[model samples]
Target: MTAQGLLGAGVQLVLVVAGAPLLVGLMRQVRARLEGRAGAGVGQPWRDVRKLFGKDPVTPRGTSEVFRAAPLVTVATTVAVVAVVPFVSTSTVPEPGADLFVVVALLTAGAVATALAGLDTGTAFGGMGASRAITILALVEPTLLVAVLALSVRVGSTDIADIVSATLADPARVTSPAGVLAAAGLALAIVAETGRLPVDNPSTHLELTMVHEAMVLEYAGPDLALVELASAMRLTVFLGLWSTLFLPWGVATGTGVAELALGAVLIVVKIAVLGAALAAAEVFVAKLRLFRVPELLAGSFLLTVLAVVAALVPA
Candidate 1:
């Protein structure tokens, strides 16, 4: 990669790491205020991360290096994802990182890392969390995969950059039936992927009701910070990908500094709007019983199938 590309990639990495916590804090603040209480400021997650980093990390007896390193792996995978996800420019940094399949694999790898970390702890609750999270993520993956596949089929490219570039160049694709159906499926996948309401609750402390939290319950201090930051980054990247792929209105198209700067501003605006909408929607929904989760994903699967079929239709 050229020096310019390296700089751009570094900028994207900083955005994912810094912006992830802000996004989480914003959502939490919104949720808190909507429920009629004073909320922590949007900077709260950053403060929490700083506090965690200053403290010591503790690992239980008999735990292996995989347990100690899982948090780092999760964070690194997310940063790598940000490098390719087109948050600023329609072109991914380093160029070759645009495949939709690769993005899915990276996302799955992060989840697997979390599961392994949980299992490595050798605690009953930790193993329980790992099993539940792994199972849910495995089910969620097919819908996400199929949704993107529908988009790829519509545009005739599996490279996210190319697919998005085509969509931006042709505004009509935004309104196509296939696009609409695929977006519906992707939206559901986003919810499930983020561990949000009606799928999993990010704020829940109840052991029986938590999936993401249970796995991380054994972590403390800096390790916990990495895990938390990774979770936040995962949520941010998913939202960014959703915006860049589906609503890519202001994404940068040129290599100019100005274009990329404008793209950055627009990304913040788009994700903020999306975050608020999600928070408001969460206020009204009850969590689905675990057994019912598959039904939700199955509905997304059907919509994606229709989207794929719709893509084959004459325009």
Candidate 2:
């Protein structure tokens, strides 16, 4: 990798790692304020993570290595995604790694690791959560793949960097019918994949309704801390990816210090705006009943299919 690419990757890594929790906190604060509650400040997630790390480690009895390794696997896979994806700069190194398929696989790997960890726990909640999580994953991954493929068809390349660069060059594409449809489908997939409102509630602990929270119920201390941090990072990463793909205007095209710095600032701003909007929207909506989720995802899949068709049609 060139020094420029490495530098860009380093900047992105640091940005995602440091900004993830703050993004979560910001969303929570937004929701709290809209509901007329004085919420915990944006730094509360950092404080909670710190406290969890300080506690004694605990592992449930009869748990195997899968339970112990899931947290690390999730974090590692997400970090790899952040490193390769062109969040701050299009001049990212190892461009081939930024292939849409590769990035999707990394995301899927992390999800699979989490599901396996849930199954390894052997508790009723754990098994239930794992089954539900896998079900969501099965539906979500295909939608994610097809949604991005709709964009890729126009660019003639499946590499994410190429798609972003193409969109940067042709700003009008963002408003085109295909672009609008793909964005909608991708946004829904992100909401489902990240366990957000109307799909799975991050704040819910009720076993009957829990998906992500149920799987991790048995973890404690540092392990739980890792899971929590990874979850935050995953949300940040997905939002960043969505922003880069659909709103790539601010991304740096070069490795110049000034460009990279500006790109970093813009990326943070884009994510913050999106997070606040999502949080605000969540306030007015209720989670869909469990059986209705697949229908929602199916609608997303249909939008993406239409997007692909639109992209393929002669102008």
> Whose lDDT is greatest here?
2
Distance from true location, Cα of 83 in model 2, Å: 0.5
lDDT of 1 by residue, 272-308 (tens): 8899889989999999999999899889888988998
> What clash pairs does model 2 have?
none
The prediction achieving the highest TM-score against the true structure is 2
Candidate 1: residue pairs that collide: none
Candidate no. 1 TM-score? 0.97
After superposition, candidate 2 runs with Cα above 4 Å error: none
lDDT of 2 by residue, 169-225 (tens): 999899999999999999999999999989988877997799998899999999999
* Prediction RMSDs, each to the true structure: 1.2, 0.9
Q: Quote model 2's TM-score.
A: 0.98
User: Can you give the lDDT of residue 175 in candidate 1?
Assistant: 84
